[model samples]
Target: MIKILKEVFQLYIDRSDFFLEILLQHMAICGIAIVIASIIGILLGIIISEFKKTTSPVLSLVNFIYTIPSIALLGFFIPISGIGDKTAIIALAIYALLPMVRSTYTGIETIDPAVIESAKGMGSTDYQILYKIKLPLATTVILSGLRNMVVMTIALGGIASFIGAGGLGVAIYRGITTNNAALTVAGSLLIAVLALVVDLIIGTIEKFIKRKWKLN
Candidate 1:
C-alpha cells in the first residue's frame, strides 16, 4: 500500500497538467448542472409553496427522478444527448432537484404564519412579501440544499466518465480496468479533495447568509 501511495503521488507530480484539465472538466459540468438545477428547483418550490395542493405531486415527480439509478438515467438520456457531457449534466441536474425543491418548500412553509399576516396587515403585496420576507428567511435552507447538490454533483461527475463526459473518473476507470492502483487512488483522492473544498466554500457562504439575514 505504501508503494502504491508513492506511485500515486508520483503520478500526480508527473501528470499535474492532465490532472488539472480533468479537474476543470469536472468543475464545469458540475457547475452548470447545479446552477440549472437551482433555478428549476427553486422556481418549482416557490410555485408549489404558493399552490399548496400541487406540492405533493411536484415533490413526487422530483423524487421519482431522483430515485432513478444514475447509470440508468444516463442511459435514458443517451439517445437524445448522444453520450457525452450533455447527458451527464442533464442527469446530474435531475438528481439535484429533489433536495433543492424539498428544502425550499420546507423553508417557506415553516415560516411563522403570523409574520406573513403582519406583513399583509401593513398592506404588503404578495410579491413584496415574498421578495422581502419569505425568500430572505428561506435563503439558508435553499443554500443548504444547494450545498448538498454541489457535493453530490462532484461525486456523480465521476460516473459521467462512463459516458465519455471526461472527468477524473476517466483515470479511475482506466486504473480499475488495468489494475493500476496508483491511478485509481490518485483520481479518488483528487475527487475527495475537490468535494471537501467545495463543501467548505458553500458552508462558509451559508453561514454568512444566515448571519446577514438573521435566519438562524
Candidate 2:
C-alpha cells in the first residue's frame, strides 16, 4: 500500500500538467452547464411562480428530462451536436435543470405569506416584491439548489469521457482500457476531492447568505 501511495505521488509529480489540464477541462464543462442551467432554471422558476398554472407542467417536463439516462441523452445528442465538449455540456445542463428549477420554485413559493403581504401593503409592485422580498428571503433555498446542481454536475461530468469529452473521466477511461489501476484511482480521487471542495464552498456561501439576510 505504501509502495502504491508512493507511486501515485510520483505520478502526480511527474505528470502534474496532465492532471491540471484534465481538472481545468472538467471545470470548464461543469461551469458552462451550471451557468446555463441556473439562468434557465431561475427564469423558468420566476415564470412559473407568476403563472402558477404552468408550474406543474413546466416542472414535469424538466423532471422528465432529468429521468433520461445521461448516456442515453448523450447518444441522442450525438447526431445533432456530434461528440465533444458541446454535447457533454448539453447533457450536463439538462441534468442540472431539475434541481435548480425545483429549488427556485419551492423557495419562492415557500416564502412567508406575511412578508409578501407586508411588501404589498408597502406599495411594492410585483417586480419589487420579487426582487426585494421573495428573492432575498428565498436566497438560501435557491443557493441550496445551486449547490446541489453543481455537485451533481461534477459527479456525472466524468461520464462525458465516453463521448470524447476529455477530463478526469478520460484518465479513468484510459486506465480501465489499459488496466491501469493507479491512473483510475488517481483520477477518481481527484474528482472526489474536487466535488467535496466545491460543496464546502457552496455550503459556506449559503450559510453566509442566510446570516446576512437574517434568515437564520
The lDDT of each candidate is: 0.91, 0.89
Question: Which tens-of-lDDT digit does each residue in 10-108 have in candidate 1?
Answer: 999999998999989988998999999999999999999999899889998998998889889988999998988899999999988998899899889
Query: What does candidate 2's lDDT look like per residue over 74-111, in tens digits?
Result: 88999999999999999899889999889999999998
Q: Which stretches of candidate 2 lie over 4 Å from their true place?
A: 1-3
Q: Give the Å error, residue 46, model 1.
A: 0.5
Per-candidate RMSD, Å: 1.4, 1.5
Q: Which ranges in model 1 have alpha carbons more than 4 Å from their true place?
A: 214-216
Candidate 2 clashing pairs, residues 3+ apart or interchain: none
Clashes of 1: 0
Q: Please report how far candidate 1 places residue 138 from its true position, in Å.
A: 0.5
> What lDDT is reached at residue 90 by model 1?
91
